[model samples]
Target chain A: MLKIHGIARSRAFRCIWAAEEAGLPYEVVPLGFAPGFKLERPLAINPNNKIPALEDGDLVLFESLAINLHIAAKAGAPLMPTGDDASRVMQWTLWTGTEVEAHVMRWGYNAYIKPEAERIASEAAAGKEALDLRLAVLERELAQRPYLVGNGFTVADLNLACVLYGPWLNGYDLAPFPKVKAWLDTCLTRPAALRARKLREG
Target chain B: MLKIHGIARSRAFRCIWAAEEAGLPYEVVPLGFAPGFKLERPLAINPNNKIPALEDGDLVLFESLAINLHIAAKAGAPLMPTGDDASRVMQWTLWTGTEVEAHVMRWGYNAYIKPEAERIASEAAAGKEALDLRLAVLERELAQRPYLVGNGFTVADLNLACVLYGPWLNGYDLAPFPKVKAWLDTCLTRPAALRARKLREG
Candidate 1:
């Protein structure tokens, strides 16, 4: 059995969504946090001690996006693209990690996660401004295509949608980028994504 | 021939290095920054207006690491690992982007890029402290094996070596992590990397 070592509420949610999409049965090890939100202990599987490490027999792996890519590769086709489309998948995935995610997290933490008193309004506003610039790029791309790669849903959509999910659920308005909002809705409404959301909500 | 649409000084250096390693012929389209180091105009090839976009036939891709992955995929074999090792390559690449690169850049900018008057000693120290934690993880992994993936040099090593190149070149000492220093030396000294360095230097 494949084991994912992290809580559902963490970035591990991405791997869970990917596993669900790929129809890969996996167990969550429910690793929790120490005080101050640190990992409870150093993870042997991930020397960086971050959450969402995947264990597949002897092959232990870290990085949530990379784990999803591996799951897609293992499941093959539909989830993973072939030929140059594979590169497109990677392009969007890497783009989201570098360009979109940090801003999303900053906004999410201030808007949703942090205690109200600890939240910095300026930081959240700055994050949103940064996101507005990047979302315009995504909005343009989504206006041209139904999905991130090719015409079908793939791990790229899954990876990016999961990154946006936090802010979306916390009522971050997507009205500004209708195409992005529509595309994200199409991605999150999939049966697999719904199932993954159930695990997260629980 | 691949047309890499960025100068050698930007993150595009990674792609240039990867092309050299893969023995692929490529041309650089010099992209210059504006007065504040911002892109002078919105780039058509990359809506993000980022440097290091790769143009291959009809496919246009941004994100330097992703471009290198694509180049590796095109070249195949020794540069791009097969099977699960491909996942390992993705793993290290993503890990470096998320966990390592920003800190390296922070340290690099304060230590090397910014005029001395603009450099913040505390920020540089903080970046170094954060990098020390991450490098310890890398040091452990390198100590276990000479290369990042499998027994051979692959894109993972190439991706990470380039990220550290700025700090390493600016005299950030790697003496504390002897294994990481040795492995980086091995990677940077390759003929391909030297060729890429010449492009950067010239």
Candidate 2:
């Protein structure tokens, strides 16, 4: 059986959602960080010691976004696509990781996740400010299409949506980007995404 | 021919290197930023207004790493591989983007790129400190293998090496991780990489 190592509440959430979307059966190994942000235990599969590593028989893979792509490809699902669509999938996935994830993460931690006294107001505001410009780009793209890649839902949508989830849940306003807001709403309510959300937030 | 829309000095350096390594004929369209860190003009290819967007026929792609992967794949060379090796390529590509690029860029800017008056000492120090732990992970992996996947130079190495170029040039000291230093030396000295560097630096 395929095994995904890490808690659903972590980046493993994206992988779990992808697996569900691909209709692939998998188990969560529950690896995570201990106090002081160290891994709970050494993970031979990933020297980086970060979680959401995937074990598919003898092949081990790390990076939640990469893992989701592998899961989707293995299932031969539309979530991964092929040819030019696959290239588009990769484009959006990398863009989300490099451009969107960090800002959204900073905003989420300061705005909702951290203890009230520990939060940095400036950090939260800066994150939101950075996100505003990127959201405008997303708004333009989504205004033309319902999903990131080709017409149907794909891992691109899944990856980007999962990164945006933090901001959406933390009350980051989407009032200025109606197309992004509508696309995000549609993405978050997918049956597979809801199933993963249950595991993460239940 | 592929039209790479960006200056060689930007993230386009990675794509240029990849195209060279893949032995593909491509043109550089020379899109770049104006003062105030904005694109010199609007880029319909990338709504984010980032450079390093790729145009091949009617297909357009942004994200330097993703574009490199596409170039390598189109060439059908060892740099892209296929099957499991392709997955490993994606793994390392995403890992470099997520775990290494930002820290290295921050360190690079504060250490060398930024003018003395604009440099932030604390930012450079913090970036280096964070990189130390991640470098240990890279050291372990490099100690075990000459290359990231399937015993050859691939886009994985290309993607990662390009990201590390900033720090390497700024003298971030890879001495503590000899294996990483050795691997990086081999990667950066490749004729294709040298060609790209000439364009970027000249």
Q: In TM-score terms, which candidate is top?
A: 1
- Give lDDT tens digits, candidate 2, residues B98-138: 88888897788899988989999999998898888888888
> Compared with the true structure, what per-residue lDDT tens digits does model 2 show for residues A138-175?
98888888888878999999999999987876689999
Most accurate candidate by lDDT: 1
- Give lDDT tens digits, candidate 1, residues A132-155: 898999999988989999899999
User: For each of the candidates, what fraction of the native contacts does it recover?
Assistant: 0.84, 0.86
- Model 1: runs farther than 4 Å from truth? A34-40, B34-40
Please report, as a residue range, the 10-residue window in candidate 1 chain B with the lowest summed lDDT. Answer: B31-40
Per-residue lDDT of A159 in model 1: 89
Cα error of candidate 2 at position A18, Å: 0.6
| lDDT by residue for model 1 (B1-202), tens | 9999887888888999999999999998777563334465877778888888999999998899999999999999889989889999999999888888889988888988899999999999999999989889999999888899999999999989999988777898788899999888899989999999998877
Q: What value does the lDDT take at residue B133 in candidate 2?
A: 82
lDDT of 2 at A97: 89
Pairs with backbone N, CA or C atoms under 3 Å apart (clashes), candidate 2: none
